[model samples]
Target: MLTLYHNDMSVCSQKVRLCLAEKALAHEAKHLNLRAGDQQKPEYLTLNPKGVVPTLVDDDVVVTESVVINEYLDDAYPKHPLKPVDPAERAKMRWWTKQIDDSIFPATGTVSMSVAFHHQYTPEVLDELTRQRGPGYRARFALLQKGTDNPNFSDAIKRLYKMINDMNVALERGPWLTGEMFTLADIAYAPYITRLDHLKFLGFLDKNPRTAAWYERMRSRETYRAALAAQFNPKYLPLMEEKGREAWPRVKALVGLA
Candidate 1:
């Protein structure tokens, strides 16, 4: 049996869930409350030393990391392949995935977390943000820092702008990131792109028409929809449902899904 240890609001977790949906595979899902630190519990830590969400336990083997989990599913379940058959094509797919992770994911995470934490939490993370004084917030901003000397927010936005431009260029090539066929690269990127749209970072799309069209394609897929419904935050559910028609089709098409 396949079992997924996930958190509803985690983009990485949503990636794995979407992979399962694409494969038309049935799996057990265990939702971890990240704010509650359930992923850090000893039992969960035994499954993933890093204590991260979206850990996939397939029989006895455990897999951590979203891209790894997605690849594993494609390899282990042959029904619907999310990777390219050609080796060179596969390499290109993997390259785009890595690029999206390095450039897109962290920026979206930092900005969204900043907004959400400010709005949702009782005691704002702003207290944490404030201790940084003028520039350096000392509360071990390590997790979201992404190996940069610049302050976290500055670093995140820099990477984000680069990623948005890169995505726009790729979309001009049409349909999916790895060209006409949908591949792992698209799957890896769709969730984060969907997230930016959710945060009304839609300006990123408006600035790049190709990206806007590409995103509309990605949003129309059953896999993307399933993942969105299954993994989006309940707090964001109403918002997501309301705006989903606008966001998901583009993302689904981006992943080469209907």
Candidate 2:
């Protein structure tokens, strides 16, 4: 039996869930409470040394990293292929996922924390949250406290805008990110874009109509509702919406949309 260790609101976890839903795979779910530091427990660390969510176990095999896990799912279960059959297109698909891991993922965290999530934590709670994070704790705590004023905030906005612009360019070729097929590339990016939507950063999509339209199509997918929309944390949603609206003007200014 396949078992998945994940969190309801984690983007990485959402990516894996999307792939599973698309493939119609049935698996046991182990949900983690990240705020309570469930991921940092010694037992969980044994499974994923990095102490992150969405770790997949297939019988005796274990997989970490959302990108790798999704690829493994596609390769192991061939019935519903989430990758393009063409080599070149497959390469294009990898390029998109790579960008997410390399930059976009971190950018999403920065944007999310700086804009909305930061407000949800107090200094004591923040300390507990980052207790097991070691070296990364200082930076995270700073971003949480400073919000949009953090030095990383501007760069985060710029990176996400570039992603939107790039997506628009890619969609001109066909319906999805890599032309024709709704591959892993689209599934990978679904949560990040959904984050922007939750954060009320809709203006980012305003200039990129193609990207906007693509996102609309993405939201309409059954997997999107099952894996992402339906799993939103009720506690986080109200906070994100409130702070996101307050941050919108500043975000617009940072991106020169003002």
Highest-scoring model, lDDT? 2
Q: 1-258 in candidate 2: lDDT tens per residue?
A: 999999999999999999999999999999998877788899999999988998999999999999999999999999899999989999999999999999999999989988887777677767776665566886767756788898899999999989999999999998899999999999999999998989899899888999999999999998889988988999999998899999899999988899
Q: What's every prediction's RMSD, in angstroms?
A: 7.5, 1.3
Error of 2 at 117 (Å): 1.3
* Candidate 2 similarity to native, TM-score: 0.96
lDDT of 2 at 190: 93
120 Cα displacement, candidate 2 (Å): 2.3
Deviation of model 2 at 165, angstroms: 0.5
Question: 158-241 in candidate 1: lDDT tens per residue?
Answer: 566567678789877768887888877777777777776665556556567777787778788878888765456768755544
Could you tell me how far off, in angstroms, the CA of residue 5 lies in candidate 2 after the best superposition? 0.7
What is the lDDT of every predicted structure here?
0.70, 0.92
